[model samples]
Target: MATDLVRAFVREDLKKSDVVAEVVSLVTVLEQEDFRKLLQEFVDGIDQSMLLDVHLLNGLVQLIRNAPQGYIDVDDLVKILGLLNTRLKDTHKQSTRHTYQLALTISQVLDSMVDSQVKGLSREQLHEPLSDYLEELKQDQDPYLVYQATYAY
Candidate 1:
């Protein structure tokens, strides 16, 4: 039921700013239930190659962010981040901003996973993305963006 509801939300059309809050609420509820398998199945079924609309991706990021720490698999996070990176462009400013937000949230999530001593994600899995994202932040032309990215770390 949770998966179906979340998937429906992802499929439905939503106003730009509304997706994040709704998804965060849903994630919090799912976290209380410890719904790992449901999230895993949903994430695995998604096609990362396709261009995701910003609203949908924003909701996804929020979902991951608010979900219980270490509940979301590292592999799923990696795939979602890769898809988000592909969609990160200057053309859509809102999406780009949310993507940065996602990046920051991901850094926190990774830290929580490490602190909790979760297995399955190797140190390399955690470090590689951290380094790559840090590099990306450093190269960003916007000082504000770099600041946001670094502050997240």
Candidate 2:
């Protein structure tokens, strides 16, 4: 419950940013089955406000970057992660450095989550997504992320 409250607080702060709504909207559309919207409709709407809220986005990213199965509040956690791949997918060098930085911060937080003791979560659910994101961080060119993943596993 504490973690949930903490996450909620973080989410509230993120929403205060000018871009959160746009980014969340894009992410929602990305999750949709319509293919035509993913590229045009989604990308056009995203902006720095949504992309640049470092703490809020990172908190959401870390919240779902890695998760355990059977956790009492698993669904709440997983929903947060939906952004890293979609909302943050536009990540790049000059364009999204800060966004990428936030993602990196999330990687660190995710590493901690992986290392932390978990209860009520299934190992499969936890490891799959976490490991996937670990690789994602690696691809993002943050080599240091490996150590955290090593500890987490």
Candidate 3:
């Protein structure tokens, strides 16, 4: 029921972030299994097409940021990180303001994941890709991207 509502809300022409946040807050009160299911649904629903839309991206980021520890598994994190990495690479080539925004957003997501101390998330899983991404960012001509990369480091 809640998942259906969330889907409906997201499909609407005028999506409301507050509504989505409220739904997430409600889901967090559910039993652990149900909460995990919702998180899985949100993560699985993400796609490359959604990356360019800031509203949709923000919604997804909020969901991940608010998720309880242990609910977001290794595979889910890998998927999210992979998508962000791909988008970051593509956006960097374009060299638009959106690239910096995305970099900051991705940095926040990474920070949240690390700060949350997600269960079973090993340093090996996070370090290599993040290191590579940051290194790439440091080489970019965009001062914002370089600053973000340095700050993230």
Best by lDDT: 3
Candidate 3 Cα misplacement greater than 4 A, ranges: 1-4, 10-46, 92-94, 116-130, 139-143
TM-score of each candidate structure, all chains considered together:
0.52, 0.36, 0.64
Q: Please rank every candidate by TM-score, starting with the best.
A: 3, 1, 2
Q: State the C-alpha lDDT per candidate.
A: 0.53, 0.40, 0.64
For model 2, residues 24-113, the per-residue Cα lDDT tens digits are 333322332222222222223223344455545443442233323332143433333334434444555344455455456545544444
Score candidate 1 by lDDT. Answer: 0.53
RMSD, one per candidate, in order? 5.4, 11.6, 4.1
Better of 1 and 2 by TM-score: 1
| Candidate 1 residue pairs that clash | none
Higher-scoring candidate on lDDT, 2 or 3: 3
| lDDT per residue (tens digit) for residues 1-153 in model 3 | 765665565465554557656666665555556666555545444453555655556656766776666666656666676676667666646665666766776787777767756455446756566677788778878788798887766
Q: Which ten residues in a row have the lowest lDDT in candidate 1?
A: 82-91
Q: What's the CA error at residue 34 for candidate 3, in Å?
A: 6.5
